[model samples]
Target: MTGNHNAAPTTQNSAADIEMEPFTPHRHEQCRRFQIVSASGLSYEIFVSIPRQAPPPEGFPVLYLLDANADFALADQVLERLSRRPEATGVAPAILVGIGYPETEGYNQPRRHFDLTAGPTRDPFYAKTALTFGGQSAFIAFLQDRLKPLIRSRFPADSRRETILGHSLGGYFVATLATAKPDLFSGYIAISPSIWWDRDGLLASLAVPSPSRPQTIRLYLAAGSQEGETATGEQNAGTQTSAHDALRQRRRMIGNVRDLAERCKAVCRDAVDLRLDIIADEDHSSIFVACLPKALRFTLPFSSAD
Candidate 1:
């Protein structure tokens, strides 16, 4: 059949009639958003949630959450609800700040990889991927130099009560921060931290005394019961039978977390209030939600003696 080449093709439906919903402003009442530019010109979307109750005499404790785009909702809800009933959970009201990228979904993968890892990975598998690593120092500088001051200027944040929460690579960053700059935050929560990164570089670094050590610091470490467990129930199931790299990776993750916790206790026995927890039946992905409540409680304990 001869056809006109310039004519528009016929379709089951017309495209011109479709209409999109008008944009509406939907904001979280408890949260305030801020666009902060770091010294290096990286823009961050920071979401801060102040406590509903009045600040304590010393000012409110601040929880600095990593991977904020993904974790802020859960962390904010948990803190808000638990803080309201401190008698039960022993978690007091505090300021919650989520540090996230400017225009991204749950995570800006490349940025996260670069900003979270302590050093470049030697893993053959990861080496094949295009992802970069070893921007953690710069990211920490941004936090210390720009973000903290911005938050302090706007909120009544208690510098002595600052806490940091991170999971997976974020968790790795938290551990790196703790060892490299112990005095940056008073409390550190590492949930299923990627301790297997960069040939366990972070753990190796922590072996020696940190140049900047805090006299008194609280460290909470946690891993899931099934963190490194295989479908066949083998833990740390290295490449013995199958060639699945994930199994060995998972094993490394679980082992590293435990090892890091023990090392922290041994190294900072006198100065660090280290707590290790393993949530049963939870794996790498599920452990954070399950353990966040406990972590928050530990970080913001009520002054029962008072």
Candidate 2:
């Protein structure tokens, strides 16, 4: 049939043109979400990732990750990829639990500042800023009394294989927990820990005796080679010369971490297995991602025959 070339084209109600449901982000296949209230009455969002394989005879190992709002995705992905081929990687499959705040901000900065720091800042510079501190004790109580029990009830967790991973302020929290309650976790991975916090008081306090425990403790401490450097002198000069001050601070951080590791080894004696690393060509901002793979290998090592 002949038709006019200028005639209006017919429209069809094809599947693509039909109305469809709104798009929602696809959830991770093995991850689940839940909420729990802390001892201080703060509600926290917890993300749990379980392995696809069946649990071993003892149970699945568990890793408690801090700063979950920002780090959970990376932790989950790394665990999944490495554990996929345990024979090649020597990393076993395990459960990963990320503890994060429910606030709209990816992180609750004020709460973290209060929870992570062991005590008030003695440095005049930080003191002038009026930041809050000294909530580590309460947070640890919450973890021990409230969170850990809940996790145990919900999952087949191997208490002996439990590990904790933290970076920056979270790393500081890890250190505080390791010293204050050494029996809590079997392994601790503190990447670029803020040993320089509170005028190095935390590092200084490491000289005190850690609680004696029968279980072997594995600790992995790492920092970026470029951390705390003033290579470009880009900051503005103030009461203190920014570049010089920054360089000094960086040197202090490196030194303090090394000293803390050594002191921990001494006090822990044969009970603790400590390993410290300086990641090449990395800095404070980039260290976490760069060091996480090695940190995971160290903290979660497994044999090929397993």
Candidate 3:
């Protein structure tokens, strides 16, 4: 629904008695949306997709999705479908809550850059872009202090089975969150995370022991096979790779995520079970779509013991 959300509904026909919000409602999903303002008075569009089935006794697990304006529909659809055949797919039905900005259609790039990153710094290449950053902490605060509680209060959310899912910068946000608040969610799905966004050493700090930890730390890091920010190595039989390309590939979206998994494994092996996926034939833009199904599998993983 796109209008003055604070205002009452309206109609233009002289004989019309009522008018409804403009949303084309989903036919099969119990989905709804509303506007919320945070303690800081930042208004957000909260998109929710609830399971059609009743919750389990312990309650349905909740998977919180970032970059909702872009990925929420995908998550909502894939999660609902796979969940229908959980016995085979191993993806249980769960509540999918998308956090997104008001007054945006797709990615609100400016808001995301600030909301998902951890530092005001950037790679030299970005120096010319003059991009501002470093709002992950405040964003996490909104999730922890307000959003999560609101969802739990209103839904049958499984407290012990909460998970976070994101892509790219959103992925970066969750990756950084694991180090600072490892116990905030039971699991994380960071697809093609911009691991290079380490100006403040968020990735490095993963190896550092935290005083607290999640009861179970399952980190699923996925990226496309072609996610290198630039050419990975020398080209054309010893021809020197472009300096800029060489410099840019350092982000090594796939390599860095693998490296991240390895680093966390080395330090928290038993405590943190990690999985990394390099999906074939996808780049950063298409990678998340290709991986969404598998991502859902990870979000509500099958338990062998079960």
Candidate maximizing lDDT: 1
Q: What C-alpha lDDT values do all the predictions have?
A: 0.75, 0.72, 0.74
Ranking by lDDT: 1, 3, 2
Residue-by-residue lDDT tens digits, candidate 3, 173-280 = 888876666778888888888888782486567753344654557788899876664323334355445774566476767778887887788877677767888887
Order of quality (TM-score): 1, 3, 2
Candidate 1 global Cα RMSD: 10.9
lDDT winner between 1 and 3, please give it: 1
Model 1 CA deviation exceeding 4 Å by range: 1-28, 207-215, 231-246, 249-251, 304-306
Q: What is the clash count of model 3?
A: 0
**Candidate 2 per-residue C-alpha lDDT over 1-306 given as tens digits, one digit per residue, 9 for 90 to 100:** 111112243342222333322221233566776656555555566778888788887778899999888888888888888988887887888899888876533666766777777677554446566456777776788778877777777678887788999888888778766766677788888888876675355655553334555567888898877664543323333344765665567446677678878878877787788889988778776788887778878878877534
TM-scores for candidates 1 onward, in order:
0.83, 0.82, 0.83
Q: What's the lDDT for candidate 2?
A: 0.72
Candidate with more favorable, higher lDDT: 2 or 3: 3
- Candidate 3, residue 159: Cα displacement in angstroms equals 1.0
